[model samples]
Target: MKKPKLELDEPQPRKIIRADKAPTEGYSLVVDGHFKSHHDTVEAAEEAGMALKNRYQMLQIQVYDAVTKTRSMIEWPAPV
Candidate 1:
């Protein structure tokens, strides 16, 4: 008897995002739904996330609140 071969596929976004676990004990900065950085406070993480999103409008940036257990997406600003 012959066995069938299996095929594996992976998603490749424009920018390679790190496959890391988000901070479970503090605020975290997530990029493209993947864990990016950890911050002591929510404000710091929010600021960094916003700045990165504002600079690169193509990326999906977000601020994750570990305490509240929620994630907020950083919407791109409108053209002036």
Candidate 2:
């Protein structure tokens, strides 16, 4: 007899302007200065971040490159 799991083991919390770099080997999805998760490629990281960005639209999300120690901000274009 064991209790059923209600949620999967996934990082959902995201947000600011974190300047620190990730220590992991792959690209990291940083939300509001926090490392949410890591991806094998930049495309995957951006895609994941975009999902969150599209939902909230205000959270500051970025993809941190562990090798380059650089981060790129992701955003949606303003409505014309």
Candidate 3:
């Protein structure tokens, strides 16, 4: 018997690092549909996400780019 392929739906907008243009191209970190914090650069936003994940014991954290409209997941280390 042949197996069938599964199709996944396009991912929706989630936690993202929104790049603000009006007041400088700063990046903001969002989590669980809420605006958490803002950073001067994307790297800072990513680092903030990592800290938040560890501090809150989040299962997973996703990051999206406001300008490019792309998404990525934050890699979390396994608990010791």
Candidate 4:
């Protein structure tokens, strides 16, 4: 007797931040400097801060009106 082959696959969960409509007013994303781990949301950011050894600082982030795509960078004195 021959056995049938089995296929194994798993899906990974990820966070998606979407803007249905562009905001007339600009917004800011502040990440704490003490944050160490990778973050996908504000809650994750806080978790990263708690995990870090040093004091966390707020990182100032500015969203541009013209740009359609979002971009991120590592800044000193991170924000929460």
Best by lDDT: 2
Could you give candidate 4's per-residue lDDT for residues 33-69 as a string of tens digits?
2212333454444444433413543443332322343
Off by over 4 Å in 2: 1-21, 78-80
Taking the tens digit of each residue's C-alpha lDDT, what string does model 1 give over 1-80?
88987867865657333447555667888888788888889889888987898899899988889888899887778334
| Residue 35 error, candidate 1, Å | 0.5
Per-residue lDDT of candidate 3, residues 1-80 (tens digit): 98998879978878554334322345555566555566676787788888878887664565556566554566676334
Regarding lDDT, does 1 or 4 come out ahead? 1
Best by TM-score: 2
Candidate 2, 16-75: lDDT as tens digits: 334464554779988999888878899999889888899988899989898899999988
User: By descending TM-score, how would the candidates be arranged?
Assistant: 2, 1, 3, 4
What candidate 1 gets wrong by more than 4 Å, as runs, is 1-19, 78-80
Per-prediction TM-score to the true structure, in the order listed: 0.65, 0.67, 0.50, 0.22
The lDDT-based order of candidates, best leading, equals 2, 1, 3, 4
Alpha-carbon RMSD, each predicted model: 10.4, 8.6, 13.5, 9.5
* Model 1 accuracy (lDDT, Cα): 0.79
Q: Give lDDT for model 2.
A: 0.82
